[model samples]
Target chain A: MHFPISDVTINPIYLICLGFFVGILGGFFGVGGSFLAGPALFAFGVPMNFVVGTDLIHIVGKSIVAARKHWTLGNIDLRLALIMVAGTIAGIQVGVSGIEALKKINRVDWVVGLIAIVVYTSISFFVAWEGWRTSKLPALKSKGKTEDQSAVSKDKMAFRKFTRWIQRIPLHPRVSLPHSGIKSISVWAILGVSFIGGAFSSFLGGGAGYIRMPCMVYLLGIPTHIAVGTDLFEIVVSASVGSFQHALHGNVDILIALIMQTGAAIGAQIGATLTQYFTGPRIRLAFAPLPLLGAGLIIYGLITGHHTR
Target chain B: MSRSRDIKSFLIDLAVYGVLVVAYFILVLQFFGGWLTDLFHNHRLGYAIVAIMLMVTQAAGLEVIAHFVLKLVRPKKP
Candidate 1:
């Protein structure tokens, strides 16, 4: 299809297929799918600005599809998600303004890319190691272990001591999220974590779910399934804000987003349904490689200065 | 009989989404072609508001459609 806004003549089939593949991953992981889609769009000759903007547009739509499916399965923690939004919005403003300042200094490209590569690589390896360790535990072999409950319990013990220590801080106005099974967590703690996620999202120009999902499970002690659903819910709101901002800046190609979303909607449904068949640890294990892939892509971009925009 | 009903429901759901998507596209094009340009020229904030409203409407509408389809196609438990 010839998308005039980006002035790119690409096959619609390829875009649809890309959307389908990313949609499945996004639905399963609660991400914006930009780590995969952004590079592919750049490779297809779309400008970097348009790639980010258009990806946000598709992400908003795709997230809605995925989140709805997850909601049907009772996976979303609406209370937590709503609370996080306040911090996320504030963080996004800070990140965006910081980037604008960096741009004025003419160091936004390589500096940002290098930091992204380092951060993505470190986090990816850590998540992968944790997933690998969990997968090897004897608890994984427990009989008829639906939802990997035994494995999850064992994993909880490892992080439980740390969480307990953090929970002891005399922070006021602690909130309890029953859906996520979190008994009590200070509102400040939730906002602090959400702010960092939102900052990474705006700075890296990606959905930030890669960071937030793991944090929800590991730090906030939310279950993996609920984290995925809540992440998607967060993505829907953040991506909507991002797409609108990008559109105002004349960066989005609405036609491309519209076409890609058609495939993404279908693929998201399939991916969300497929999650019902997998255990929580198994899902985490599968997610471990995606960030590594993103890290590798950023490194490649840094080295080649290809698609640096 | 159940299988046929499920298929019929799926088709109807698909048709509904298709209609909504088409309507959404028309609305976007109409707004962009008419008032949106002027709004943008007058105030960037106005453009941002409209753009957000449009995007949110599209996303919400698509989510509703997707939820309906998923409900229709949910696997039957034995």
Candidate 2:
């Protein structure tokens, strides 16, 4: 109940329950559940620094469980995850610097919060529209479960033509990821997307999987299932680096992290397994509103001037 | 699997998980609490490594046990 590392006295049961709930979201959506967990922890009297840093370490643990499950289901593309790690770390630095710059200008909270709201809202609407449009595709609805199953298990995208165009860029150092069904995609594109993901991680807080996962699906042309798995793989590495840095700075409470992870372990397993029952687009559709929820929170904070995290 | 069978398997998994959780709290958290708290104050580098190590090991270890239990409870159909 008393976490001496952060010097916070909190209920262990609350931490466990929160971890379980967030773990489900992380496992199901391939996003760090920090959007919920961060605010909740702050409300429960965990220091903001510990909330952010401890959450990163917690993410690493949960993602490991979820990622392993996805791996067993043949969903991970290791090559893709490895490449993205490099860009992600670099982008985090840039994002951190951006935060400092905004702080100096005395507009850090408003500017950053507004930007996040716009980004989150746009992503929600875009994904919702895309998911809605694609759910109506003739190939999916015409027949019964067979046709629907294929479209669900695999990917069928409304933005296929644009994705194909992005894929056709003749960058010399192209990489082939046959597992993701991406043949000869420019390495630059992968780095660019991951770099943006990393930027969002540091800038917006959490793993920024909400942005990165969709980028993988729409821009890199990866299936939603693969993107979810691969994103978790990427999170395991990036969040480790982040948590370590936060630990060095005395922001992490390992005891708290460990306790939370116990509940997360179960939730992650259930979340990852449940993914197999849904289609790619349906996953995206379900994921759409999470960002909106985040946006609503930011808007609440902006109006009230009562920052949650 | 049928929905009912799936629910039955899930219920069994939850029971097994509940037991493991109690054991973990009694054996691991209770024992390590003092040492980990000492490490947090006196040895941050050690604490950081241990934090990551503990989280990863506990998570992976628990998942393995849970997965095994799940498999036993939900035997594959021929």
Candidate 3:
């Protein structure tokens, strides 16, 4: 039961090196850090709770770097970022509360595991489906299009309807922003997503970007680049708030986080720089499996009675 | 734009190290020693789990501190 530093301590140099690699992958794909870091740490004998908390911090750092990089590229959609933050915060609150409730029944892990599995798998399906659908389209194939434009058009009609449903409600000052070309938003949708994100983040210790980003990009029809940039902005606020909350409750381990962050800080920069060389699909192809594999690892660990103790 | 980014990046990196070092020291004083010992005395699995978790928490704080510092750090090279 005694986890002396000697028992579980990984070489700081190795962790830093790993952090650098994760950072590069994160910058290239815009994820992979949280999704992979948690499981990787778990395998290394880290607890689940700490993994979540630290992952959030890692995300906060990476997002800051990523957002700034994107801003320089003229890729950020400020209006969307603002609205998403509104929803993202609300969602985190609900997520935290839900975990509190679930813990009472001693079923929090199961609930979190279920959500993780569902969200990760759904993402895998969507991305894989997109890849498949694109390959099947004749015009796109012949055009030598690196991407299937059809996916956008086909999804557009559905996304517009969804957005309209979201926009029908009145919850704001009717603020107009040129970035989104709208005077209003479905505050309800934003709130709904925020609530979902909050609960998922609190219980699972990671934001449901699998859900949030897709909702922003496909459901709300925000551009993908903006979605990445804005998501980072929202994470900076929400994850920090969440981390602070956990810290107040004495759930955060400051030392390990510090060391991890040291590496992450350097990693974030490397990631941001690498983003310039990689195309979106190439990045996705290279990095998409990390979370899926992480999810698999967790499930395997659980099913094999890794947590029975 | 690229040159500015590269310059800003180095500044961010420097700031990250500064913040993370400070945060980790605070954590070491607050919980690292006691928590590790408690895990040793009680349930080993629990202790290991906690240790892992704590490491993760430390990592998170480190990441945030790095981010904040990076933001404040000027792009002097640019």
Candidate 4:
């Protein structure tokens, strides 16, 4: 019997092993493991579309696990989740269409590549900045850590000023969430971020968290754990929708998705469990290298014209 | 006393499952392509078929493991 290979289909065993390792990394770092998933699938001769589509599907399982774990830990801010999801879904849609439009003019790949680099660097810098601040000013750092979990900070004028600005916007009939202190946020902002998240999920198949999680934490004043949970929860929607859209275009490979998702699911469990061992910043720091490496690889792929095996 | 509430909760649960199922099928079809086209266009649907099998098996298998872990840690209500 002859085995079929794509431009770069490594052994199935390799894919499974990679999934396991990436799963651990994701769990340890609080990411969806798409950073690893995309490249692994690519190595297996999966087309860019399938790599992305399946990667999104793969993320769903892990996010479910992570979100549940966070919820149980009382780290989930339900209201903030809803708001970020709203933004992420909307942002992703616009991003997807924007990609499509760019494709017509034939520069989609480069545009996306550039955006990914920028997003990657920005997230890296944010994480690094936090580390820098902590090292420089222990007093200032300790206050921001989740360890200082007091009721919403009244003294943090910056937080209050930003949050007040959010409140002043006319967002009536704001959706309140269960067990969360956040009352509401602008639907427009939610839609905007969601659309961008959607586009990222659609195009790259797994970068939504990089965008949505941060937006929730910084712009929306959501706690880091909640942002992580909600971001994962929201990916289920974004990925599913994007996957369905891709399937309509006939790009999904259920069998491949199944295999990788299997390894990924087990990995997710381990990953979610691992979250208990590390603080948000520590986890972020630990996993920081993966995205930086991934970005470099993608740039190499682009320059080499080697998207596939 | 709470039949109405139970019904509403059930309905919501149903909606969530419905959405998940629909989303799953849609995703499967998108990345793998429709069965007919995949068969015709490439004449090599075998890889895709195997891939789907791998993903589904992994997901279901892990869920079982998770259930076991959950049960071991906190037994389900009888």
Q: For each candidate, what is the lDDT? A: 0.68, 0.75, 0.60, 0.56
From the highest TM-score down, the ranking of the candidates is 2, 1, 3, 4
Error of 3 at A13 (Å): 5.1
Off by over 4 Å in 1: A1-11, A28-31, A47-49, A69-79, A143-147, A176-184, A223-226, A246-251, A273-289, A296-309, B1-43, B63-78
Q: After superposition, how far is residue A293 of candidate 3 from its true place, in Å?
A: 1.0
Tens-digit per-residue lDDT, B1-78, candidate 3: 877687667666755674566556556646667765565455455653554454445545555665676666656442
Highest lDDT model number? 2
Give one digit per residue, the lDDT tens place, for model 2 in A1-309. Answer: 677777778999988897887777766765667776765665566654566577778778777866777889988899999999988888877766665566456565676667767877887898788677666676645555543354544454556877898898887689999999876898888898999988877666678887888689877889888998889889889878777766766667777777777677667657766877764666778877876886776666556553222
| Candidate 4 lDDT, A1-309, residue by residue in tens | 112222244564666566667777775665666765675555344555556656766765555555566667877665555565665565556645664565467664466666666666666676666544434444544676452232123234447676557645676655544454556666665555566667677777774677666555555566666666666666655565555554443445554555455455445445655565566444555656676666675566566553321
- Docking quality of model 2: it rates as medium
Q: What is the TM-score of chain B alone in each candidate?
A: 0.60, 0.79, 0.57, 0.47
Clashing residue pair totals per candidate (backbone < 3 A): 0, 0, 21, 49
Residue A194 of model 2 has an lDDT of 93
Candidate 4 similarity to native, TM-score = 0.70
Best by TM-score: 2
Candidate 2 backbone collisions, by pair: none
**Could you give candidate 3's per-residue lDDT for residues A54-120 as a string of tens digits?**
5665565556555666678877777666666677677666666665565456554466666666766
Interface RMSD of each: 3.3, 1.5, 8.4, 9.9
Error of 4 at A74 (Å): 5.9
lDDT of 1 by residue, A219-250 (tens): 78888888888888887787677666666666
Please give the TM-score that candidate 1 achieves against the real structure: 0.75
